[model samples]
Target: MKILKNIILISLFLTVSSCQKWLTVEPEDRSTEDQLFSSVNGFYIALNGIYTDFTNPYSYGAAWTMTTLEILAQRYNVNQEHTSYTLANYGFQEETAKRTMESIWNKAYFQIASANNILEQIEKRREIFTSPVDYALIKGEALALRAMIHFDLVRLFGPMPAQGGDNAAIPYYIENNRKTAPILSLNQVLSKAITDLENAIELLKEDPIISKGPLYSDSQLGGDYQRRYRTLRLNYFATLGLLARVQLYAGNKPSAFQHAATVITQASTWFPFIKTENIMGSSKNPDRIFSTEILFSLQAPQRQQTYLAYFAPDLDGKNILAPLSSRLDQSFENNQNDFRYTPLWASGEASGKNYRVFSKYNNIEDSRLNYNNRIPLIRLSEMYYIAAESAENPNEGLTFLNTIRNARGLVSLSELAPEQWKSEIEKEYIKEFYGEGQLFFFFKRIGKATIPDGKSVNNINMTPSKYIVPLPESETRHRN
Candidate 1:
């Protein structure tokens, strides 16, 4: 593995003005590793830092969520003059696209290395944690973070499991040291990720979210406030949701169904569907992203900035990320009643032309709202999709699929032929995860030969060459 030297020194501290929050971190401090890991507060700061890093524009904040991957998924209309035009056309080898991919690669591994550092130090400083729950929460989240990053790496750079999982893919970093890690096959990397998640699930058994639910909050444990906002952290259930995602990606249908069903049956109350009042009734501050259903997300304070940068209606055609109005209408099946459609997308004029702009991440007037800054990574509706895809029978699968549809103000889908089940599920993925960036992976996983074109009425032909993103040249040159 090509390690960035600065990431190896993973010392971070928080600049909290009060005890009510612990989300902010000051990374410029150069505190010694020993001094930083001397207490449990230090561990909390380090873990929180990893979560904060995820919000950077190069990662989930923009590139992974609304820009690069979204472009690759054909979710927007990018003209030839736009900077992301090459990405929209799958030009991975272009200079600008190469830099984008390289930044994503390097940022992912940097966080992985930071997580590994915490995993290493926690054991050495175990005595500092007076409460076992504190130890488990920190260590478990670190493992989950590492696994999540590696799994995304595999999804991006590795072949689909059904296609060529035995082929060598990416390196799975497990240690904090500088020794080059060996590149492993896709299946091997997935196995390692599964192992990490299994361990995380076990360690997170003490997670209070199990008993008190995801919204549970209490006083600080060991002088740091890590217990609040369990849903925002990896917590117990989010880890399960991620495992279900990974299992489905690895083609373990039975295992995926089991894990996904567990979340649906047990945690449904914790993450209920958004009430109609929260969406249609509250026009001033609608919950467009359905924050209540978010199993895990990043607390990105800069989310409004992200909205203005890409989806704002005032941006010129080449600068904005809005889709063709007709294309977006087709994705949602032209259902005006669908909560994900009308409330989340609105008509606006940009460059003297009107378009339906994505407002899922738009700023809310009330900062105190729970959904304001959250960028969902895993959601309850996704579990239903996974279960529906992996279920043994079409009837059972349709039931799983229709639950989310009903919640989104659509009627339940009737039983369909087994051959038609995949198509139905694909439609839900397109509508449910519009800007969240799972559509490309969905197409890649199924090896779909063509997808709806974002710019026109035709379908864009696809192949493995277009599906698999090449590893950055920086890493390849190092390997050579």
Candidate 2:
């Protein structure tokens, strides 16, 4: 095994110096700072490389971002045939589960180290950048990426926000070094992450993509817009959107509400909700991660087979990873008109017979939508929910809730009593982010138990302690 200390010391800056090939991770170099920050395009290449990490199967690409979180949320059926039996059964102690957890943990810190190296080198060779805007853009994104990775690490391994401010959490590694910084409390990590994002927002305001409309190729630095797919990268607005999520997770309800509301209003032009007309009877891949509903996403290439390996009925006779039909039925609550219902979950009987397979991560070959198996991390509807949940007045909160309901083709209901708002929000959360892996965080945020199982009623309340996955054995075995 590579020394954990050594792994934390180097950068991921590799070979293959093509800007178009930014998404690919073919590194000929050992990822030294001088080699990566050699010129203007080098910074661009390094920044784009971070997004590539999101597609790694060990990290956000599959395990931590989608499948594992879905399993933890009890969003799927639990059976021997399902791949998530260990996770759903709360098998954190098992060797396989620990290895999975360790891979995610290790991969996250590796990227964090890269981000740190990039930021340091950007400052060291400040004159190398032809302009200030490029410097700021690269640095801002690096800061946000570091904070984002650390934030997820904390949520996965740290205590819930409701557990109070003083609980020990994940270590925040800012420097590209072998020395591990001491772990801070949950409150500290949240504060540090917010600070980083705030700095990022200031620099990203000058994001050329925002003004250029789309990418264009040219000789000058500012003229090139080939990689301006802002949605895929954490652009300025997406950074703001992420701030809303971080704020909510930190238990700052008012701040979360305000940030989310801003994104809903300002980012609407870029991420308008999918129109009902385009969604129905379309062979295109607009409904999934590649859809307009996405605020931030990951470009996961060659993932179609991964989807087929688990969800495709004909390919795998012993398919392991699906939900109970009863659980899915109740999740939709028997609303056939709901737009989110039909596209995301269809009968397993379509290919085989029995459980409901996840269709959200399906890779689509739509040249029209530019769909290519992207993985969405944040969506527009989440803002509405954040605003709704954090709103003070019952009518105010209900208005936000109704907006999404109406969009999904469900009839809008009148304002419910104030006490019912939480459950109302819960219902939307279930439907809005089913396979997207958000339910666990929702539960952790609100101390929600009695989660949806095979049956809606008479199910055991999920134990509170299970919400926090244990520190990986690699950390425990090696830590001072």
lDDT (10s digit) by residue, model 2, range 1-480: 121322222234333223334444344656555665688787776777777777777777777656788778876665655556777777888877888888888898888877887887788899887778888888888998988898888988888877886998888887776775777999999999999999999998887656543232333345354246666677777788789899999989899989888887777776667887666656555455426777777766546656876666564533446666777778889887888877776567766667666777775555334445667788888999999988777678788889999988888878687678888889898888865767888888787766766323336476646788887876766574
Whole-model Cα lDDT of every candidate shown, in order? 0.85, 0.73
> Compared with the true structure, what per-residue lDDT tens digits does model 1 show for residues 1-480?
555433344333333223327665444556667867888887887788788888889989888888888898999988687768999888989898899999999999999988998999999899899999999999999999999999999889888666878998899989888878888999999999999999999999999788767643444244435777788799889999999999998889999999999999889988889998999888789898898898898877778889998888888878899888889888888898888998888778544667788888997777767788779899999999999999998778888998999999999877787778888899999999988889999998898999987777788999887888998887888788
Clashes of each: 1, 6
Model 2: worst 10 consecutive residues (lDDT sum): 1-10
Candidate 1 runs further than 4 Å off: 4-20, 26-29, 216-224
Report residue 463 deviation for candidate 2 (angstroms): 2.5
| Top TM-score model | 1
